[model samples]
Target: MKFQRIGEHGAERPIVVDGEIAYDLAPLTGDIDGDFLASGGIEATALALARKRLSPITIEGLRVGAPIARPQAVWCVGLNYAAHAKESGAPLPDAPVLFFKTPNTVIGPFDDVLIPRGSAKTDWEVELAVVIGRRARYLDSVDEAMDHIAGYTISNDVSERAFQLEQSGGQWSKGKCCETFNPLGPALVPRDELDPGNLRLRSFVNGESRQDSSTADLIFDVAYVVWHLSQYAVLEPGDVVNTGTPEGVALSGRFPYLRAGDVVELEIEGIGSIRQTCRNAG
Candidate 1:
């Protein structure tokens, strides 16, 4: 099932999309979003509710917002794809590599991506994002990790390779935490509703395809990454984990970079696509 949030008269409401978003589920789910999603674990309850009543909302009338409201963190993995690792001249890591960007970096699906001041290596990374569903720590195995996932969304891991590689001595956070780095949502499909093994992940800049691949290429798959991160920090429901992007990022490819007017998009099979227009940060 796809869970979403929409705006009505400048106010936002949670919605369950059966066919369209505006058919209204107030009769079925009671409240807009915070409840339904935070209610009984969105995956199970949403599917169960849709079985009895279809939503009255039409997908067109409502303005879509990020599927998960106010995520706690927007975490990411770098160079997790073998080819991407090779292109960037990075060695294959022995374990799941991790880094983080502030949740403040999160923006809506179709929002604009800003090129930070003095940024010359602004690039794009099309990634598969996992949204956590419960507060978890010390997960024992990969299976236990998968159980913590609430849903999936497409993310544009917009990066500034200069800030990431040049100025930072410690971590990649400098290049990654620009104002509009994380573009999330369109739809958040519950984990059980889709298969993660094979999804055609693709990215395009200014109408030309750039990054294109599938989840099958990750050096460390989703389950292990989650389980590993759990040992360090507790995973909370609604926190986003960018499972990492496949190859074709500017940092890895022929050094293509975004300009003031470039349009960027990332899509994954089944989940959905997200787009952002590029503009100079004033």
Candidate 2:
């Protein structure tokens, strides 16, 4: 089953999707957020649907917001893909390189992505986004990390190379935290329904392929990333962790930087795809 929020930004209502039909989750929960996930919302939703307690609704013309409500924090793993590291002329890291995007940077998968004003190196990265389902602090082992994950979703980690590398005195978040930089979700697939270990994730620009890689190439996989972060900071429920992107980005000099009106599409196998039109920030 897939969980989603449908309607305008800031006013979306939660719903669960099973095949062709969509069911309202309003009777069971107000929204799909940290509180809902931490309290076994997914399990309860399953049970409610099984007993025909949810009302089926049509979503033909409505907007689909981010699958999970705005997360408390959007954690990102940098240089976790060996090929991507090589493409950017960086050495393989001995440990996971971490960074963050402000939670508000997250937007609906199909929404517009604003090109930060005065930007020339806007780029695209298709990543596997993990949604935490429980509070994890100082986790004992990587094996136990899986238990805290609620589900998986797709995140288009839009970036501005110049801001990320040259302008900010070496901090990546400046380039990362622009409004609409993180386009996330058409649906959040439960962890039990999909394996995050080897899914294929890809990105395209203006109908041309830009990124094409698999999670199999991740230098630090999902479990290791979660456990590794837990050793340092507490992982709160509803926090999103972007595992990182693969090679074939504009930063590699393989393609031109994004411009206003360019369309970018990111897709992950099983989780689904998101498309965004780039527009200059007003």
Candidate 3:
């Protein structure tokens, strides 16, 4: 099953998308958020839909917001893909390289992504985003880590190369936390519905293909990433983890940086896709 939030930003209504029909989730929950997920919302919603307890609603002209509400934290893994690491001139890490993007950077899937003011190196990264359902602390094994995940969605990990590298003072979040830097969703596919290890995730800038790679290339797979993170920080429900991007980003100097009016589209196998227009931040 797939879940979505549709309407204006911050005012979206929760929904369950089954094939072409969208069922209202308002009767069961107010939003697709941490509280809901932590309370078996996905299971309840599925059961309700199967019993025809949910009302089918029209979503013809509604805007699609991020699948989940703003999370308490947005964690990220850097260079988990070996080719991406090589392209960026970084050595493969023996362990996960972690960072955080301020939670407010999360935005609707189809919203406009702002190119930060005085920025000339804004780049795009398409990544598989994991949404945590259960609180995870010091998880014992990779096998156990799967139990804590709720679902997966796509994330456009937009960045300003200058701010991330030249001006970051060694902290990558400086470039990652800009408003609207993270465009997530269209829908979140439940963990059982898709295999995260081999999904195809790609990015296109202005109709041209940029990053095209599968999660199979990940040096550290999904389960290990979750297990590894748990050792250092508690993973709460609704917190998002972006599992790094593949090769072919602007940071490698292979393509031109994003400019205002450029359209960026990202898609992950099984989890649907998102498109965003680029505009200069005021």
Find the candidate with the highest lDDT and give its number. Answer: 3
Taking all chains together, each candidate's TM-score versus the true structure is 0.91, 0.99, 0.99
lDDT of 1 at 8: 46
- Candidate 2, residues 1-282: lDDT per residue as tens digits? 999999998899999998889999999999999999999999999999899999999998999999989699999999889999999999999999999999999999899999998899999999999999999899999999999999999999999999999998868988999999999999999999988888998888999988888899999999999999999999999999999999999999989999999999989999999999999999
What would the per-residue lDDT of candidate 1 be over residues 6-82, giving only the tens digit for each residue? 77423556666664434454554543333344456465445556575544655575566677777778878888889
- Segments of candidate 1 deviating more than 4 angstroms: 8-11, 20-38, 41-55, 59-62, 253-255
| Candidate models: Cα lDDT each | 0.79, 0.94, 0.95
Stretch of 10 with least lDDT, candidate 3: 1-10
Candidate 3 per-residue lDDT over residues 171-238, each given as its tens digit: 89889999999999989899999999999998999999998999999999999999999999999999
- The deviation in Å at residue 13 for candidate 3 is 0.5
